[model samples]
Target chain A: MLQCSRLSFTYEDASQPSLKEVSCRMGQGRLTVVTGPSGCGKTTLSRVINGLIPELYEGKLEGECLIGGEPTTARPIYRLSEQVGSVFQNPKTQFFTTDVRSELAFPLENTGVQPEAIQERIDQVADLFGITQLLDRDIFSLSGGEKQMIAIASSCMMDPQILVLDEPSGNLDVEAVASLARILGRLKDRGLTMVLIEHRLYYLDGLADDFLVMKDGRLTEHLTPTAMRGLDGPSRQARGLRALNLDANEDASAPASVATEKTPDLLRVRNLTYAYHHDQAPALNVDDLTLSSEDVTGIIGRNGAGKSTFASVLTGLLKPGDRSEISLNGTKQTARERVEDSYMVFQDVNYQLFSETVEGEMLLGARRTDLFREVAQKLDLERLLGRHPNTLSGGEKQRVAIAAAILSGKRLVVLDEPTSGLDLLHMNQVTGMIRYMRSLGVMVIVISHDQEFLAQTCQRFITFRQGRPVRDSRKLGNLLQAL
Target chain B: MRPISIYTRFLLVIFANALIFLTLPTPLVLAINIYFCSFQVIVGRVRKGQAWLLVCLVFALGASLAMVFPENLPGHYLLFLFVGVGRVLPLVLVAAFMMGTTKVSELVYLMRKIHAPQWLVIPVSVLFRFFPTVRHDYAQIRRAMKFRGIAVTTGDMVRHPMRTMEYIYVPLLNNATNVASDLTSAALTRGIGDPGPKTSIQRIVFTRLDALMCALGLVLMGCGAYVAMFQA
Candidate 1:
């Protein structure tokens, strides 16, 4: 369904070509998985097949790319929209409407499809994607997995013969990834060809028909999954889905230290309840929650279940009006006053990055250079001090935000979705930082949807449903059961 | 918090005090305020080395023009036009500084500290988040247009601004709504409206230094007001 012949593309300003003499062909109704290390032009190749090269990104194109026997370069992207649909890496970027139903109807409307046809397609795709219950919900309110699913469903509404997905499940949970794989399997059964560009192969192993490997911007190997697995070498073995040598270890809770006379709890909450004006449900309703100096609390819930809201309230970003009473180190305080005592690394790094340079951002509210040096060394941000915050990659940005929050000298730190866009290496670094925070006797609360992250970084888990803390457990099994 | 640079803070305070004087009710004070403000804004946009010369030349030309043509007929209209320009120019310059230098999150934080109502805080925060996201959306749309081989020529843009608006508006509205929902959920999750004194880790306290600065601002404002009232 897709073919590229000696397709070399060099960016307009760059000194070297992004993709060099890359040649590959993808068969119809088959799933082709493209895997490569970071910065190997995986995204560049996907852009080429989708007619974004030479067209969207200004570049020198030297070769032909054909989609289903038609030269893609000759056809406008709108025309190609009928034959190929693409879902980008970030779901937030691709959406064109507020509600799920309207989002599903967007592409069809652009293509001048009749209203009836559009409605019919929306219904069909919604059913297929199991998003009927989500049709009326605000698009932004949906969880990350839900948003990705909607993005996929919206693309499916175009009824394109081929679907191209760029890291579709990059930020999803394991269950969500499994769900995505199942969806892909069903799509394949319907004879829809797919090209998935991904780094993690946990979910794509059995489903992908063929493996296409690119290294240094060139097509290095193209073979069936079985054939690729038979090859030798550590790189090949890594590509073929051998267990990664990196530690994926979950936190084995330390043997209960000899109980010294317990010091008084440092933080206490009593009858804490909060609800938004528009919400028919409460966001958080916890009765008598307490944390000692050494508690590493993990807050987990479905998206929009108020985990982040709880963190914000605890961190003093949001003030609870009448629904909660919070005593910090035994003193009642307002959100503004609490700001001096608690810090938060927001989910979106952009909000927290207020300065032009990394050093300035890290030292925004910092009092001591010693604290700054400690976090800067740990997060490896000392070298990045001169660079602009926006210039850094996603992982780099996350680290910078973490470093800044830590340097703020807040007694209690809350991290919201800290590992969302991070790779294994960066994720390990952040997990280590969390451990370090706990070792300093600083109370830490992590709000995340990543079960693995929570399992690895935290000792206690709290689950919220409809803004109410329904379960609290130290055991992973109990946490799972509660959720 | 890192102390605001002394020079920048001084400029801000001076500019703010000058703005307050210009906005005062007296006619004479308003006129002088306008005159000086106009000089500041227009001259500010010019490079520093040549700006003084340009300002002097403009001033001389205006004075000469008024002296040569002192007739009642066009002089009143000219005066009115100059005053209008003067009144607008400083406001525009200051607005630019405000928009460019102040981060939206900081503005929201300031508003929250001032105890703004939740309804107001919610919308403002939403707008702040949506601005960047919308800009990103617009960029993506433009890229999509280019990839689709739709030539985004200037002529086409001028002729079909609606088409451009269509591209911008659809995605913006979509993203805004999504962000709003996210904000709502985030707010709700964070217990934003809980009725107790909430504790914050990152406190924006008005330090002794900040108090002293505020006192200096008040004193400056008092002096400006006194000078405007009696010195002239």
Candidate 2:
């Protein structure tokens, strides 16, 4: 069992304690779900449990945290790694190897485990997590869900008594979330202690045994799933808790603006085939494809399955082969000829930002002063004008990129993985921006693995597999089940 | 007034530097050179106070040296500083400002507008995108090192520079390979090599205000050039 007695932690630079007198005990062989709003110290608590708080981060501690009846202060982080393994929020941030095999072996090697033992554990964990096919694959080439799965599998290979995941499904689609839930259930059944910090509560239905609600770094309540389900009205202060009670039927009652309808085709691709080099396999291939301007389309596929490549092609950031043909607004143009008519908001916003200040960054591709002013004011970027581009947070940078793309006055805009690191609030803000973009008669294509985002925004779904378009469906439920 | 193309802007800056080099006295040339070279902190349109303060200090030092030293000694010093600072600093400052303010798309648009060869813009855009990826890869490698108990201290870096290079280069090369593929696809999709004048939505027209500014700049250049010719 894990126990904390009046645990309080204050970072060196922070004015107040992140966790204030937080006391809780996680029982052995039980799954606990910690739910809270963004920036409420959910991640901090998870870090503390894994002994990263006082060790990795220089901070003040004013309480006793015990693991397995031993004081946590007595053991260093490396030592605690044997007892507790943690998977961070961002899968890419924690990855140490290029290949999945080496990635799975990393933690074991760190603890001086035998090579044979490491191999044995990797095989067992791979089979357990159904990642055997992915072991030889490149780490960067994995999809959002695949990467998260690898991260979880790598942590489990450590053979820790407890596993702590910080929003494991935050970047996954609905289908991937279901897969994650099943994996967690399997792990829970095997008697592994699990602590999940997540905002999406629906996935925790069968996995979470207890619910721990945190606010202002303090544990406000520790109730069983049964007790929490009995709460009446929307009085449940936790945003995630309220979302759990939402019936599937209520989703249909939402305004028509929630799921736009497919209108006339605005962009069409005929025999679109693209390859990086003459010898390499084609990055994208489509016999005949059409996209409507009015629909919010969700592009779902495994990593390297050409979702981003398609977006790049659509936005004129890439060139297709000679055999490839594209028609935009009934005009046939080669890939190179269509670039000026499109805009793209990149996955890494920093790559496209060349200006010193946020204001200058927004004006990078803008032509009209009037449009610039309108976009600037609408995006609330006027306040951030004087600040350096690099100084803004991840979500702010994303918004600036979106504003810039909108100001470019292109009829078509492509957003690639725009919601990767955003919190709940920022995610809402970004979705709102997408709506605004759509309202301007722009043909917007969103490339994301976020199922909640797709369900809340998209009306049509397109799936890709093995560099080929597999399915195009108008029914959201049908697509979710298919995936 | 339309703003000049990037090529024109590049030439204009070169001309301005040449004029400054010719008209200013040996001491002032050295002062201006040092000022521009060390004024990296005062980039873009904003006036950074710290950079301005540093420029003033350098100016005072140059002036004192010119006053106290003999003509030959100060002339040699000024000549050396001028070559180092004056010849290189202005170009560096101009390049920095241009790069720091111009987006890759804007550059692509301008290049396409001027009918620059596809080989030129394609390679340049790829290089531009490569820089940020390289920086990100370096950071990832550093974090991976820290996790592996390899301290990236200055002493360690100095002792094993080759190892440090390996640490950065290996990951960088790996990432570059992946990014290159993505960039190629992106470039092709955008119809980069399509025939005819590419219509850019960027709309970089030379407004009346831009023309007036360019005219004033040209007049300044003309005066500087005449002064340099006569004074010499």
DockQ of each: 0.02, 0.01
How many angstroms is residue A111 displaced in model 2 relative to the true structure, after the best TM-score fit? 3.4
**CAPRI category for model 1:** incorrect
In the range A103-207, model 2's lDDT, one tens digit per residue, is 676566545566677788889999999999998786666876888898888778767889888888766666667788999998888989988998777668756
- For residue B214, model 1's alpha carbon misses the true position, in angstroms, by 53
Worst 10 residues of 2 chain A by lDDT: A253-262
Which lDDT value does model 1 have at B171?
38
lDDT score at residue A210, model 2, on the 0-100 scale? 90
TM-score, every prediction: 0.61, 0.62
Please give the distance, in angstroms, between residue A339's alpha carbon in candidate 2 and its true position after superposition: 2.3
DockQ-derived CAPRI band for the predicted complex in model 2: incorrect
lDDT (Cα, tens digit) per residue for candidate 2, span B45-74: 445434544554565465456545556976
TM-score of the second chain, cand. 2: 0.64
Query: Where does the lowest 10-residue lDDT sum fall in candidate 2 chain B?
Result: B184-193
B168 in model 1: Cα distance from truth in Å? 22
